[model samples]
Target: MAIVLGLRVLGIDFDDEERIERIESAFPAVSFVRLNGWTIAELHLECFPEKAFHEATDLIHQLGAYGELEFVEVVPHLVNTSDIAKLTGVTRQAVNKWVTHPDLGFPAETDFVGGGHARQKIWSLYTVNEWLSEVMGIDLGLELPPMNLVKQVDGYLALEGDPLLDGAKDFHASGL
Candidate 1:
């Protein structure tokens, strides 16, 4: 179990089904939400979350329940621009500019972790994979090019190593 913090902080359990069962049985009057969808973004729920929902990401650590359900508290996933640089093998400044996509005149799809002065975009590890598959045509193993890695030299998105993490980043930063 971990404590989720945001507008409100709450304790979440993800070790096993015991916590889920306990919450469900005890809070029969409360709303219950199911983990569903290719990305499992928690579209439906029995009740509104007091804070951000916690997501136990499947980052190749477990294969059996890679897409299975686990209880998570709601919270924004913290990420640094450098992490984006590693995923795309580019300089942090270039990655930050890429996130903005000002030259392309396109907006990223995302919800800022903190609104107003503290606002910053929330990037999902899962969305990065989908963009490569659907837009870049990468494979399930996260292998091969176009999706794996892209290098922008002379202002062109070039093909690089296997889209190790799918040569892509989901958000081009903006107020959103």
Candidate 2:
């Protein structure tokens, strides 16, 4: 069991190959790649039998603590605007307006899909929670479920591995 961490560092220049090389050297075991035009580096580290999931997760947290990472939140799952509205005890329309309002400090949706007539937006739950507590001065009082529940569901509902990891592996294997 392994956990994949996605880090967003704001200061780095993603287009500079030399800077990327330096980052790769700093983390030889982990895979790092630019995230489009976001100026963020996505790191993927998969451990074998040597490191347990919890240990790996801890190390990843430590890296964030020691590095220049601007945002380091564990992305558990994606939630829609309606879900956020329900959690915050507000209407979906209110949530939509909040997303567009820059003063609310709401995290931007991770994705936007559909054609001109139809559009959908989605956000990472972790980010939403962080913004709620840190920016909005609101806490939904979220707490982890019982260990029994976690063990039962275990891998059944975990987020899929980061695609950058898969693409990195392929690129390395092909000597690209």
Scored by CA lDDT, what does every candidate get?
Answer: 0.34, 0.55
Candidates' RMSD to native: 18.4, 16.0
State the lDDT of candidate 1 residue by residue for 42-114, as single tens digits. Answer: 2222222321121112211121133233323232233445655666566888756756766633235455566
Candidate 2's TM-score = 0.40
- Ten-residue segment with the worst summed lDDT in candidate 1? 148-157
Per-residue lDDT tens digits for candidate 2, residues 1-176, read 34344444555566767766766677664445554345444434354423433443444445445554444333235678888988999899988887889778778789976768777888877688888889777798764322232232232112213444544533332323
The best candidate in terms of TM-score: 2
Residue range with the least summed lDDT across 10 consecutive positions in model 2: 151-160
Pairs in steric clash, model 2? none
